[model samples]
Target: MFFKKEKDNFPAFLLTSLVIILGVHIFALLTSLYYILPWFDIAVHGMGGFWAASFIYYLLFYTYRGSVRMPCFIAFVVIVSGTALVGVLWEFFEFAMDIINIPFLGIGLSGKAVLVDTLLDLLMDIAGGSLAGMLLLWLKKNTL
Candidate 1:
């Protein structure tokens, strides 16, 4: 029941990636690099997006009993949409952390900066999702 099929190995890559991301994020927070370096946030968000999309793709493929038959565009839309939703949820989490004065996770931005940062984060999420979707599509096509 844990796995859909016998061939479905553990999601090592996903778990490993999540750990790496969390480690890097913690390091950034401890070193204050996230605050000192603007691009750091963007880079992290991009990676998060890619990871989110990949997770969604894996879940979709894993749940189905047959081979992938969907159109590339539709797959792209689904992955990107899922990633966007994740990004929005993450932003909300961050906002909540800021409101609650949570250490390391809150940026505490105000006014236009908050809006700008959120927009940029969403854009990076989309960009990363797009890249992952394209890569997955290519892999599926070639493997099939």
Candidate 2:
């Protein structure tokens, strides 16, 4: 019943939004749009990071009923690290899928391409996570 709980609505909503975004990406991949559209991967990765961070933000605050007086630096670190961990896990999943020859979502990259792609994805993830972290910190200071 966790999904039915009132306090879980916002996180559920955030996750739903992520599902929609992922659906779009999956569609693009299936249609080979990523091959035609160069920036598609970058856009999806950045948005993934943003949504992942936002979901973490909501999760953290929703679980804490006391005063939301954490230092800005600490909050930023928590958000960034959480988001980065998610991103890394995703990369690992992709690698594992490739090893298992899963045709659905693997990028199917070789040595240099795999390294470059992973690094760029991580960089974009960090960029989006940092933005979310800054916004959350600002909101906590001013509104929460």
Tens-place lDDT per residue, model 1, 1-144, is 123332254267778898998899899988999889989999999999998998888876766664666788898899999999999999999899999998888987899999999999999998998898888767766665
- Worst 10-residue lDDT window for candidate 1 reads 1-10
Candidate 2 structure quality by residue, lDDT tens digits, 16-81: 888898898899889887778867888888888888888888767776763455777987899999
User: Pick by lDDT: which candidate is best?
Assistant: 1
Q: Each candidate: how many clashes?
A: 0, 0
Question: All candidates' TM-scores?
Answer: 0.89, 0.85
Candidate 1, after superposition: displacement of residue 46 in Å? Answer: 0.3
Which residue pairs in model 1 clash with each other?
A: none
Candidate 2 lDDT trough over 10 residues, lowest sum: 1-10
Best candidate (score: TM-score): 1
